[model samples]
Target: MTETESKARVAKFHIGQVVKHRIFPFRGVIFDIDPVFNNTEEWWLSIPAEVRPRKDQPFYHLYAENAETEYVAYVSEQNLLADTSPEPIRHPQVREMFVRIEGGAYRPRDLRVN
Candidate 1:
């Protein structure tokens, strides 16, 4: 296998899964995934060096929320943990992009027309 292939790490999460920051007070649902970091260099550098994540792991795009507000967040896989809250996510965009399944996980809206 090529060096890159050998080093590749599979994402531990999936689209529509609810997750929360490992060290932050926010939670969100995964709406997209990047197999590796794909953001600007400045954005990466802005993170404190002690806490910045490596660029080789999957990154997720989330419809995120904290106690008082909601926003979009781009988070590395290492910083996320499965959010086990029984309450559904309250981000407004979540309703537009997904539907809650029976067990509380969200699923993408089926946009294909018959």
Candidate 2:
């Protein structure tokens, strides 16, 4: 993270809260927090990483959910808007099912008889 990047993550918010990327218009639950490097500055949030435009800067990247797609986005910290609305946490079993499916442990099979 660059000197400016480090100084851009201090926010007036806490983790596990809901936030929205103002530029991308995507919303997600806060996963991580970043400290400011310089003066009292903005805070960073971990946007769920995606396959495109991969970068190492945390303040410039964010994870958000659009419908069913979970993608990573690169946006400035100033562009991140705090969402005060409470969001329901994902059920453990449901999350496990998704993991299984994504890991290829759960595959669809053809059951039609010839």
Candidate 3:
């Protein structure tokens, strides 16, 4: 196998892990992870070129919170860090998707769609 093909892409964060932006003042819980950029070009272009993340890395979908309010955010893996705070997330939507928090991880309610 080629060198690049042999290197598996490992997601650093899991579906229920809590995380915060490396350069932003907000935190969130991971709702989903994409192996690489899966958003629209319009959305990607919104970020300034100098700081924009590469498309080859993992991207996360989050139930996010700031000092003022809660919302959703799409963030690149390079920009995220694990949130070690023991306190549970307060986003209202969290309850709809996650059943509980156990050992600092959110437990997603299984909603299988065929």
For every model shown, what is its TM-score relative to the native structure? 0.92, 0.41, 0.86
Put down candidate 2 lDDT per residue, 10-107, tens digits, no spaces: 46544434567665647754444554322122222234444222222234333457655776443445556776545532423223222223322222
Residue 51 lDDT (model 1): 100
The runs of at least 3 residues in candidate 2 whose Cα sits more than 4 Å from the true structure, single-residue gaps closed, are 1-9, 36-63, 73-75, 85-114
**lDDT per residue as tens, model 1, 49-102:** 999998888999999999999999999999999999999999999999899998
- State residue 30's C-alpha deviation in candidate 1, in Å: 0.1
Q: For residue 83, what is the lDDT in candidate 2?
A: 60
- Which one is best on TM-score? 1
Query: What does the lDDT read for residue 80 in candidate 2?
Result: 68
Comparing 2 and 3 on lDDT, the stronger one:
3
Q: Rate residue 97 of model 2 by lDDT.
A: 24
lDDT for each residue of candidate 3 in 51-105, tens digit (9 for 90 to 100): 9998877899999998999999999999999999887889998988996666788
Per-model tally of clashing residue pairs:
0, 9, 0
Order the numbered candidates by TM-score, best leading: 1, 3, 2
